[model samples]
Each structure stands twice: as structure tokens, then as C-alpha cells.
Target: MPNAAERPRRIRVQRDGPLIVEGPVEVVGEDGEVTVSHRFTVAVCTCRRSQIYPWCDTSHRRRRDRRSGPPGGEAG
Candidate 1:
């Protein structure tokens, strides 16, 4: 492996879930708003239902019909 300074950041994508990114990161929304995260690891939300936008609040864990909504379904 490379030394600490050369270590690569890692990102994980689940088969049916969010993108897990190594953190101390920031996300920019379409409206130009920024969301910052300082955690060692961050679960970036793919579904727009997170109350804590840009961060996964496990909202993708909810179940619903795929044909009617986003990933993990409509949550109802």
C-alpha cells in the first residue's frame, strides 16, 4: 500500500442502496446549496426522501413498489 498521504479514498455501491463514501466530504445540490460531512465514512443518499438531504438517514431501507417510486420504493 502507499503511505498515508497517498492512500486512496474508497467508495462503495450496494446492489440496492446508497453510495458509501469515505468522508470529510461536501455535496452540492442542484440549487447550489452545500452539505458537509465530517464523519470517517458517509452514506450518501441516492433517494431524495432523506430528511437530512445528501446524507442517508436509512430512508432507503423502507419498502414500497418500485414501479411507483424511487429506489427501495415509496416507503409506504
Candidate 2:
């Protein structure tokens, strides 16, 4: 078996927050557009209203709607 230190990256679900992703991950938009990014940390956009795209900018704090997936491109 491989050592834990050499394990591959994976995605972890946060109890009430964005999905915690490690290692390699791909992100796509509503139009099926793909984004390329390389970083240690990122908060994905679950509300689908973030102008920043695949990343979360905490816009969900004020969104009246909290539906998963997409919200017809509406911020709230």
C-alpha cells in the first residue's frame, strides 16, 4: 500500500460550506465552459451568482435563494 503522505488529492464536503478540494479538480460553468486554475485553496460558487465564476466570493451570505446546482444565473 502507498503511504498516506503520497496519497492523491480528493474532494471533501463541508458541513455547511463550499466543497473542500485538494489535488486536481476541474470546474465548469452553466454554459459548459471550463476554467483553468492552480491554487492551494478556493471556495467554489454553489449559488451560481458569483461574478468571479467558479470561485466563491461569499455572495451567498445575502442570497435569498440557496438552491444547489444553478440558480438561472441569478445572484440571489
Candidate 3:
């Protein structure tokens, strides 16, 4: 097995937040348009409520509905 430093970057899925990833990254839209980010790290939103699609801006942290939990909710 490779050492920790040699391992590839990971995607961390937050139950109530963004999908954390190492950048620079490109997210291609269905319309054949590509959104690019060049930061050292990126937060890809899972919640459909983001004002900025693909990239996260902490919109998931709000309480939109009482019936709802986190964006994707907790994983067993």
C-alpha cells in the first residue's frame, strides 16, 4: 500500500454541507458549459438550494424547512 502522502486526493461528503474536494476542478453543466475553479480546495454543493451551483457558499447551513434535516442527511 502507498503511504498517506502518496494517496490520491479525496472527496469528503458532508451531511449538511458541501462536497469537499481538492482543486483546481471543472464542473460541466448539462448544457455543455463548463465551470472551472482554481482554488487549492473546493466545496461542491450537494444541496439544491445553493445560489451558486456546483460551488458551495454555505447555503446548506440555513434552516429552510423544519421537516428537513441536513442536505443529504446522516449516513448510517
Candidate 4:
């Protein structure tokens, strides 16, 4: 097994989506507040629309579908 210090943390990025990171992870907000997750993997929000800040709740997907407009590029 690789030593914890020698192992690199993996993070997966998605276009218009959350960043998938290997955990357990700690996130510090602008206010100096810390958010911690102990899951095997975690989704960090990037679009800032998640009901649960820092942790993604797939809110970006909902917004993307709405902004794509209807068929033939017409938005009503």
C-alpha cells in the first residue's frame, strides 16, 4: 500500500458540473468555516446553486437543462 504522504489525491473535473474528489476531505469557506466529508468520494459544487453549499447536490444539472433552450434553439 502506498504511504498516505506519497499517495496523490485524485480529483475529477466535469464540464458544467461538480468536481469529484477522493475523500475524506476538508473544505474551508471564505468565512473560515470548515466543511468536512468522510465519504469515499465527494462532489464539490462549482456553480454555487446547490442547496448544500460546498457539497454538490446535482443542482448544476437542473440549471443546465433549463438554459439549453427547447428544440430548434427556440426558448419560450
Error of 1 at 6 (Å): 3.6
- Model 2 CA lDDT for position 26: 64
lDDT of each: 0.73, 0.60, 0.74, 0.79
Model 4 stretches astray by more than 4 angstroms: 1-5, 65-76
How far off is residue 49 in model 3, in Å?
1.3
Q: What C-alpha root-mean-square deviation, in Å, does candidate 2 show against the real structure?
A: 8.3
Quote each prediction's TM-score: 0.70, 0.55, 0.69, 0.77
Q: Which candidate order results from sorting by lDDT in descending order?
A: 4, 3, 1, 2
Model 4 C-alpha lDDT versus the unseen true structure: 0.79
What tens-digit string does per-residue lDDT give for candidate 2 at 1-76? 1224366766666533466666345676668887755676656766666778677666665554455545454433
Error of 4 at 75 (Å): 21
Q: Which stretches of candidate 1 lie over 4 Å from their true place?
A: 1-5, 66-76
Judging by TM-score against the true structure, name the best candidate.
Answer: 4
| Least well predicted 10-residue stretch by lDDT in candidate 4 | 67-76
Candidate 1 least-lDDT 10 residues:
67-76
lDDT of 4 by residue, 1-76 (tens): 2236358889998877789999888888999998988898999998899999899997776665655765334321
**Residue 75 of model 3, lDDT score:** 36
